[model samples]
Target: MPGVTDNRKSVLITGCSPGGIGNSLAREFHQSNLRVLATARDAANIADLAELGIETLSLVVDDLESVKACFADVETRLGDKGLDYLWPKYVNNVEDTKYYTVPAMEVEISEVRKTFETNLFAVITMCQTFLPLLIKAKGTIVQVGSVAGIIPYVFGSVYNASKAALHSFSDTLRVELAPFGVHVTTIVTGGVQSRIARTQRTLLPNSMYTPIESEYSRRVTHSQHNAMPHDAYARSVVAQVLYGPAPWRWLWPWAKGRKAWIWEGHRSWLIWFLLARGRPIAAAFKAATGPSVQSRLAMQQKRNLSIHEYLSARLLKTYGIGVPNGEVARSGEEAEAVAKSIGNDDMVIKAQVLAGGRGKGHFDNGLKGGVRVIYSPTEAKMFANQMIGHKLITKQTGAAGRDCNSVLICERKFARREFYLAILMDRALQTPIIVSSSQGGMDIEAVAKENPEAITTTPIDINTGVTDEIARTIAIDLGFSEQCIEEAKTTIQNLYKVFMERDATQIEINPLSETSDHQVLAMDAKLGFDENAEFRQKEVFSWRDHSQEDADELDGDIGCLVNGAGLAMATMDIIKLNGGSPANFLDVGGGATPAAIKSAFELITSDPKVSAIFVNIFGGIVRCDAIAQGLINVVQEMGLRTPIVARLQGTNMEQAHKLINESGLKIFSMEDLQNAAEKSVQFSKVVKMAREIDVGVEFTLDI
Candidate 1:
């Protein structure tokens, strides 16, 4: 009112509470010598601005009568001078209700209405009520918008929709107000530090997102960290409004200009570029919610459980199936004693490693072969000494060979005919099937690939099992000798019994031999049992050789801990796509607890080649916050030096992120898959470079 008759300009700013963009903007405008009218729902909220000599008014933007009264008051104070600038900046208050972050289906309809009314309807009403005064002064209308309107972030659907509608409204208003000599500017704000998210937030009691409820508070305050300061944002916005390009230039007959859509705050430019280029934001979203790698690994583990040759032979003997007289020995002296007890002139000593191609494989202890024929007990001891307590590297073993803790000594049997016989689960038919082949003592996979017709398959009904007729048919098809036909048929029936009783997924006897003595024997056996049946098959499960299992170390630079097989593959694929090498694929499983998380970290860190670790988990059956806390504990307990990039989604993901951030560890929490992958690769390279430099220094010192 005091500056009404003066030459100074005037601005009416709403939602100008302390520590907000509007409050800072009001002060900035006043510092520039303009008459400022800062308004809040409660005048006491803007008392700090009032103390700075700025006029404060109590106005509720959503209340129609309050908007009209405020307009009348401004009209009376300004008289013919009118208002030079109209700024409406208001958002739905989360403190008003606890169900603000609940899923769309669970949130109350009234809360949705309130949000729309506050963010969209209120601004439109404010603009309509003050348009006359604004037009009279040819002032600018600054509509505060947000990146949330453009980006589809989780847990703020209502707020995002309200802001999106406001954005659309501002675009239409800009075109409509061009001829009126009034300007409409939309501020597409990114992450700016503000009081909007200061209050604590919660989801509904029966929310479907309850598993991720810890994420709600984190999402509410997501912009508070590393966000542009409110004052800095205000300075940039005011500078753009007062000195940037004119909004109506595009509407003129000769000039070509567009409406002002200022993108300010952190990551604004990157988001704009991504949106403009039509990048797949949804892919990033999928990376968070995809099946966990741990779940897939659990499935893989359950489906794959095979025993060693010696154990398979022992099981065969129990079922009345003929096998070579053999004994497993952990030491060379024991192997000699077993060979001597058998009293055979010819014997075969084989390294008891899990991998195939054992006969052709070389041992780490300078043994030329894993399997060897011996003529005496002394020869058996010599070969056993070379085979035991050494690593056997085969085609299947890769460079990291399997450890051999024992050797099998058996009397060599001369076979008149060698044939392959196997009992396998036919998943498609949901039954057991017996496969027989005339070709044996060679790779079954190779035989199948090279000559599929050489194999004969016979399905067995679970109720009837392997009858005498079926066993005889398989023996005849396998080309068993006439004298050994009855023996072969009995062996086949006994093998089937072993398969069913042991819950065997597969039982293969490569070279089910017909000896010169007219005896049918399972010369070599391989058996795989169902891990799900471990409770009942306790003895079989106990025979599981952990040293035979695949190692966690992959000889790469980036260690990965993911939850699902598909997701783990995708995580690795994306890492490779981004020019980074993954060290290993370790799935912690769907029901991962803190203990499992610690174990996973320990396994990943066990690889000295790993310079960085990437943890990508989608918390479908697991709480992400629990996983996060576990990771924090592991890092602190182990004092891990490797950099970690963690991207957690679903249940309690936000809370997980909060814990990791507050833990002050080397773990980097990222929401976007691409960003997380790139950061991991970047950190890995830095660590590698540092290692190389250290190595160089060490070499120089030694010289």
Candidate 2:
């Protein structure tokens, strides 16, 4: 085996595209004093590596001939030294929803074949070609597996299966090559921040997946939140491979806890196959049962769902469901007054917080509990005082507890029986499901864990609202008496109404109690509305709390203002690709107003780190001309001197360009997003250099 030496160490990584793992790893390895050869399908893609003393090569892993030629080239370059590390990181990810979400039978065979050709076949070929080199050096072979292979989430079957195959290959390779002293390590990657998530959308067969394309897109965008930054992920992997001498089989740098939970939850194929096969058949059955009835429930004219408890109560009342007659108190004094209004009856003073497990929580100032049973107004005031000003920590709240700014003082009532009633969107069924159980209260999750069969679920089609017959059946199944049947049925019907009207993703009444008076009352409820439907739910949208957001976002240097989440992410990535780090991600949303755009600008510029701004808008609902006007308004009013690059496309883009060009502002309005990104980076560099020069001149003057 070749001994470790700074000059002797060499690493070759394939698929070194800009903003990719290979590119990042190559750069980092070079910085660590290792000879780095960054290869891609096109050498031109990695041309920039020459500046950093990293060699670039055109190596197509998919082509067997290309793989052989690449090996020959590596051997010739390294001469008798032998290769230290050979990373064949060529990955092809197809974004077709069917490949991930649909049944394997539904996915096109061509797509599967194409994916395996790159991800599996190419990988195997590369490993065989490089085994000799790695054996010579006693180096590590890092196989980049994914969490998808471990969990195999719904709609990601093909990709998951491909990764699973790769993982198996790596394991087998490890055992076979152990005697050769070539170590094989599988990096089970969590979500890594990359342009692939954004750019891969275009590669999806949107026309073919007409039924679920929008949902697929939403899921793709939603998943990016947990993605580890590419550079950070690369650094960790490179460190483990280069510095760590121990034979570590798996390196998990992201979603450690999540991965563990997923592994535990992963079940057998019997349930999976049944569910996958039944989806379309079930949809067809549901459609046949109804005469294409439209929903009678009124849609929210304005606003979106924000705070769970308060909004839930309001929506429950609106739908005529019985709830405790109480209001949210922002202070201890207000809580006291509300307690008084309950006329000294037994009142439950509950700290209003976004997190759950509040009943088992404690306040920061040595307060024992978040919930307290109070007899007098004074008692309510005392508990409120302890909670409202202090942070309430629970199992869900972590160590840094959320601030309890408000409390709910509600009239407490005794119940003969508690029932759990919940309507939640089932992603697999693509419909809302009513989950009801005779046993309810705080231990509902326990019931689910220990006795899942006790809960009855009824999936409802969105087109057809919950029928009276369906409601009666569910109510009866929940052990409701004949007398309470009408009441329970009414509450269930009303709950569906509220869910439809508010565009709620989930409406959970944990303890829907049957009071002594035979009334079905919502004792505790949690309502969560779909954020995508926020535009229609104006009231709910207005309830958005910005305080819960990250402080760094409010203060970043290269502020990004984009329409869609994917576009915003892509813009930020491109900015970074061009050597400029984004300070904030400020998405003005699709139907953004000129006023909203102006507010976005002000918010982004508020961050002292922001010396440059990049705006990439694909105007679908929003016109580009309107966006231009908004930018012009901000620049003129604020006299903004920050270098701005705006890339406008779709929907009156020509008009937008014309308007921006004639605005007399120094903003660069470009037709191409790449050009805009490059311009922003150049301008940011100039700004930084100018600042440094000014400081230099000031120092000389002082001397």
Candidate 3:
């Protein structure tokens, strides 16, 4: 029962079906002289376990009913021995034969259900059922999460999101169950020698008919076939699992080895976030020389513009640099009062909290001081009165900071170039990557496009400081003349120094333009550090924006809960595509808490201009039963008359869908993203027809 004191004990793993990662792990553990019990959804699946001289049992991670029954069986078999360790190698990205593939439009609700049953729901049920045993064992519970969780592919968003959710859930579980002696470890593998590579290859049917797809199919298939061997990935997993102590998360196959397809996902996200934001990421997909998947996805990966504001204006202001006139005040009284005190005839008033809303002219949360242009104190008062405790919600603020207390008041400064600059951790280079550009302020991508050579990157050795030489070069290239180069170099160097010293994950400065006064000022800035590295950088980490966070991420909607970044990203994508831009990305796909859903709706509605909504729920671990109950209760209380198009799929969907249909709420069942997107736009138009595609759901106004 003692934890980590003895490694020579029994370990139980679920979903040890033949020729799978679980089966391989079971063999390795057995070979290591550990008592290994390998389980599967059915006993028939693990007949190979008997041949390997390991104990086998019937188990299902998805169904609580089946999981409970299996746990009872496991308890009877390994009582007191108590399963010294537990591993879930269940469902290695569904094995794709012909059945897994069909026309994209032909995807069935059942297929969606099949995916979650293995990837998300079952895992939850299994964990709960085994909690007592794992507690008794005082051992580790390892979840096999994926690199796809961090990245997204055109067709694979669902799988990627499920994995992402697992990663997030693992983090929460590790924190919550830490006091109970349960050690939770999540292994985020990049690529490995597994049948999954084969399965992924099969997900796309590469014939000449889809010429663009055929070529991409070949490239992806070859890359996957050559992925690192499964055994190698397994050894990494086993070593970490058995190494006595472990961290909450480990990216085993780092970025250097990842397929370009995956790497592009992560980079594009950061890129779009840096570049064009008020617009949908789909603008990036406008490239011609790409596959349908890439074309579809490129169209959706637009920047999260609010983030740019934080980069240039907010973070820079912290470094003792002058930003175009802006002031931070806590209350509307303070805001209006500050405007009067500043004596500026024209100033921008914004919610000062770490949220975005000022630009939208909504009840802004002051996240990054949601800034708004105002003529006088009266204007400030009008904005403040409306914003006070009114929930300045947005795509990222979630439901918590809707009513903003803090506001940023400042004189508007005229400037040019919506360019970007940032210091971020680069796992590949094992150092910080400095990204700065003469282009991309409001539109980083456009900036990049107009001036491809303008964006300059320098990798700094964390061991030493960023040299004046590198900083000077970057500044000079970014259009800083000789006079400003010294100051610019020093500034760039200091930013890197701060990045390393502060253990920052990201520190962005957007529109690093020359002040109208001819001095350099960061128009916006945002700083983020590694949570794990927080211990070393207390002061920096202490500046946590608990509310401004991508709630879609914390809530597991960051594609993991929703099953695809496309879905996750497209929620934002469709809104913008339909002429009704999204306030933020709220994914209610994974196991969404009722509170999370409520927050999502609240955040979406915070922008009055978001006249309509698209609630696309492709149920995974989140049951239709739970979603229906949650929606009915939450929406009624919110008092929203805005037309809401609800698309629910997965478990108990029929019943839940029926409930919504009869609820007398403004809800419509549209099957595709296209229909939903058009419906969302239409609502904004004449306000007619509620309907929706799944890669980027179909966009049709013909409804």
Which structure among the candidates has the greatest lDDT?
1
lDDT of 2: 0.67
Question: Model 2, 572-643: lDDT tens per residue?
Answer: 656765667778656787876788878988888777677778888766567778878877888899888887
Residue-wise C-alpha lDDT for candidate 1, range 187-267, written one tens digit per residue? 443346644445456665776767776655565543443345777667656644553322112112132112222222222
Tell me which of candidates 1 and 2 scores higher on TM-score.
1
Better of 2 and 3 by TM-score: 2
Cα error, residue 638 of model 2, in Å, equals 18
Residue range 106-127, candidate 3, lDDT tens digits = 4566665666567777677777
**Candidate no. 3 TM-score:** 0.39
Per-candidate total of colliding backbone pairs: 11, 18, 73
Regions more than 4 Å wrong, model 2: 1-304, 308-311, 443-445, 532-536, 539-703
**Model 2 poorest ten-residue lDDT run:** 290-299
Runs of candidate 1 exceeding 4 Å displacement: 1-300, 303-306, 329-334, 426-429, 541-557, 563-566, 576-609, 619-641, 648-672, 692-703
Error of 3 at 456 (Å): 2.4
Say which candidate scores most in TM-score: 1
